[model samples]
Target: MRPRKLILCVEANEQVLSVRKFLLETRGYRVVGCASAAEAIEYLQGALPGSIDLLMSDLQLPQMDGNELVRRAKQLLPGLPALILSNTVTGYDRAAAADAFLPKGACTPAEILDRIRILVARKRGPKKQMPTAEMMPHEMAVAG
Candidate 1:
């Protein structure tokens, strides 16, 4: 069987954090829930490369907003997939660093799960390779 995906979830609100943690855990994810950006950053810094599959955080964090967190996370783990959640629709415009964004109360659990599944699968998908001269068709290569 495939190993469960590891997710680093950051949220300031305890109730929201617990609910999200439970939701993801029950869906077969291994979650590391943190109540602040500092805690999440510490975890990321100490974690092995490619250990965590995703970073999910709330938009309204106390110290650092989710976009900044996503940016910092990308610096640490270049290709790590990130998802930012917010209670308002306006957060989408500010979530440029995240791979996906969801309005907290607007989305159902199924929708959130579906988006996460898609992002994770996308990250695990085969990478596209640049075509070398030898890989090109004979005619195309000769024409170049």
Candidate 2:
């Protein structure tokens, strides 16, 4: 059997967090819910490397913005997929390192899961061989 995907969800609103946690858990994902940016950061710092499959956060977070949190999360786990949540999707820049934005109460759980799956699949692309000592400098390649 395939391991259930682990998703780290960061949100300041307790009600929203609870709802998301319940929804995600019921859908077969292992959800790690954090109440604040600080807590999320702390979790990331001590978490086993690559244990988290995706990072999901609210755009309006207390203390640190979602974009900043996503930036820091990616720094620790390169190629980590991210999803930004908001009450209304507006003024979001795709260049901000998030794969997609899910509007609260406006989208279905299946839609949310579908987007997460797409991001995970995109991140887990075709693998490539790492350069060996005998490989020429021109032959060196990196796969995302």
Candidate 3:
């Protein structure tokens, strides 16, 4: 199977970006880390349909912000999963665009990786099937 492609939209922080790249690549994901929301949008414009499987972004950004990034990304790739990690805790709701919110200063690298794995697993998991009824009537013989 082809490797899953992921796009990470974050501000112009080399340390954070480096750590994220290391973590994601270690997990076998093809990462395209963008320093700003505008860069991410440019990538989306040229990206193939369904190319980006996941988007992990920092909530606070200089230009467009992670929230807007996610909204636009959803429009481009509806099934794509997103996670918003930020130091500032305002305006991040589980019900909103991001699938998960990670408090930047609070969460460790391991914790962040774990959350990413969980989200990816959920996205790739098999479709749910209805449970079979415990009781069923005997089938009538067909008059073939």
Give me the candidate number with maximum lDDT. Answer: 1
Model 2: per-residue lDDT, tens digit, 1-144?
Answer: 446678899999899899989988876679999998889989998887768888999988888888888888888887788999877557276327677777777888878877876665566564342223223324423211
Question: Which one is best on TM-score?
Answer: 1
TM-score of each: 0.86, 0.79, 0.77
Q: Model 3: what TM-score? A: 0.77
Q: What digit string (tens of lDDT, one per residue) describes model 3 on residues 22-77?
A: 87786556788888988988888788866676788888778777888989988887
Task: Looking at model 2, report the run of 10 residues with the lowest lDDT sum.
Answer: 129-138
Tell me model 1's lDDT, rounded to 2 decimals: 0.85
TM-score of 1: 0.86
Global Cα lDDT for candidate 2: 0.77
Q: Which ten contiguous residues of candidate 3 have the minimum total lDDT?
A: 129-138
Q: Candidate 1 or 3, higher lDDT?
A: 1
Off by over 4 Å in 3: 1-9, 91-95, 127-144
Error of 1 at 115 (Å): 0.5
Which runs of model 2 end up more than 4 angstroms from their true locations? 127-144
Arrange candidates by lDDT, highest first: which order?
Answer: 1, 2, 3
